[model samples]
Target: MASTTSRHQVQDAQKLYDDRAAHYDDSWHPLFAHHMVQLADLKPGDHVLDLASGTGLVTFAASMAVGQTGSVTGVDISSGMLQQARSRLENHDLENVEFHQHSITDLDTLSVLRGKEFDAIMCASVLVLLQNPGQAIKAWAVYLKAGGKFITDVTHPASQISLITFERVGRGLNRPLPFYRVPFQKPEDLQLLMEQAGLRDNHIVSLSQLEAANAGEGIMAYMTDPAHPRLDKLYTIEDADDVFDKHIDHWAAELLSRPEIKNEARKIFKEEWARLANEEGKIEEMDCVFVGIGTKVG
Candidate 1:
């Protein structure tokens, strides 16, 4: 039985992903697909399940890895996302993959998978969003055949430093930023979760990416960008500019308080904002991902 908080989380996730479905692949799918494919280790003629398989990123990769004789089933909560996944499947002319609209937290209710087992189960950057990731992992493990593999990935804590930087900036402004929920904060945490879920011989691998320089854009545009799912939860469309302005003002004020580098800091800040407004300026970002692989050994 899902708790009230869990239910609300699911509803919120569904709405967020449904709205984000169209543009999700443009940004995140490419990053996730690479790690998910390697962690899943799909074999020819294997039957695989992909939970929270958004836009068929991992599903399509698994489909190709499994060859013609194998099959892959993708499950997701957002019908909108599944719709996009189905369209992509058609575009690729993939015959061995199927998708179902279902929540990762409610896998037991899925009729198609009932009384069936899979050679592997893969989830990509999704466990952290669930209210009860442990229970969900345990439930998913039941569908795996004995000695079957289960692979999942989560954002490494080091990769989340950008959010921490934002939080600090918000605090300097005296308006605390809302922290997004991220469950697996450390590698050990995910390892323990997998063990508690009855998975054996767990392995954690780190995948890191160093992005090329970015042309920095306006803070407002960055915040309200359609691909940024957290925007709606953090600020309203109408007051977003006001909120951002306030933060920028406060941040500038804090920088100006320093005597030694005050002038330089102010100049850099002003120039940066100017460049951002004009959609120019170099920005670099990096991400670290931890992929966890375990097997259910009966």
Candidate 2:
């Protein structure tokens, strides 16, 4: 993460994530399966690293996939997120997961660990938020063993069309939400970044299929966010109300209980996402951005 690219410091991002930690797993969070499916391809003894392992989402999932023989170390700049991650792991009784509070982009110090290289590194939705993702990728490439895979999953630029961005979506609603994008950052740009970082055997995965499976519709459904349907599956019927009450007024939020508006919104979204689907892969496939196993080129 670059000082200039990030308007919010690590502490700030961590703090924001920490606030959502308790409810993080409530909904299906379609992206969860994105990395899980990819990492599952690795052998048990493989070493893995998750950059910006916020609240242990990727780390926790990776721990289960890697098993005991494999080591999973998560590096992030937020202590709050690390603490939450640690707590979640302890609750799961996972002993193989290790987390260090540090900036993952330029990992100059291993005072935190003895290993110098990882078999695979997963960067989940963290690239565009950085100051200079290309440089960061190059710097972090040193930690990869030869043939190691560097995977990055980010909110697709095509996402702008559907409205997955919170700030932008917020404004579209009656209430104005945060409107913004850091600028010059997109999955396409990051793909170029992987090349500059000297990574090879690179394949970009257009992550789709989660809309009907988990969460609700495509990533854009998060745009209107009136009902905040993302949590539809992650929670029991008991705590759903509290989650909505707390979050509905937050930003591009919508309360789905309103009989008329809720039904109408659902209809519109379904029709739109469905329409996007029938067109084939033309106007960007309906899914988040994903990076397949990335090999270190040099």
Q: How do the predictions measure up, each by TM-score?
A: 0.68, 0.63
| Deviation in Å, model 1, residue 260 alpha carbon | 38
- Expressed as tens digits, the lDDT of each residue in 122-169 for candidate 1 is 998677666577888999999999989999966654344334333334
Q: Go through the candidates in order and give each one's C-alpha lDDT.
A: 0.67, 0.57
| Winning candidate number (lDDT) | 1
Candidate 1 Cα deviation (angstroms), residue 143: 0.4
lDDT of 2 by residue, 1-298 (tens): 1111223445445655667667765755536544443543666888888888877787777777788988888888877667778887778877788888887755777576555788888877666556566787898788888888888755544454334333332333332222233343344555677877888866555444244444455443322221121222222223323433444444233333244444444444334434333233233323344444468855
Model 2 regions more than 4 Å off? 1-8, 28-40, 113-115, 160-187, 212-287
Please give the range of 10 consecutive residues that has the lowest summed lDDT in model 1: 223-232
User: Model 2: clashing residue pairs?
Assistant: 5-131, 26-234, 27-231, 167-178, 170-177, 171-177, 226-254
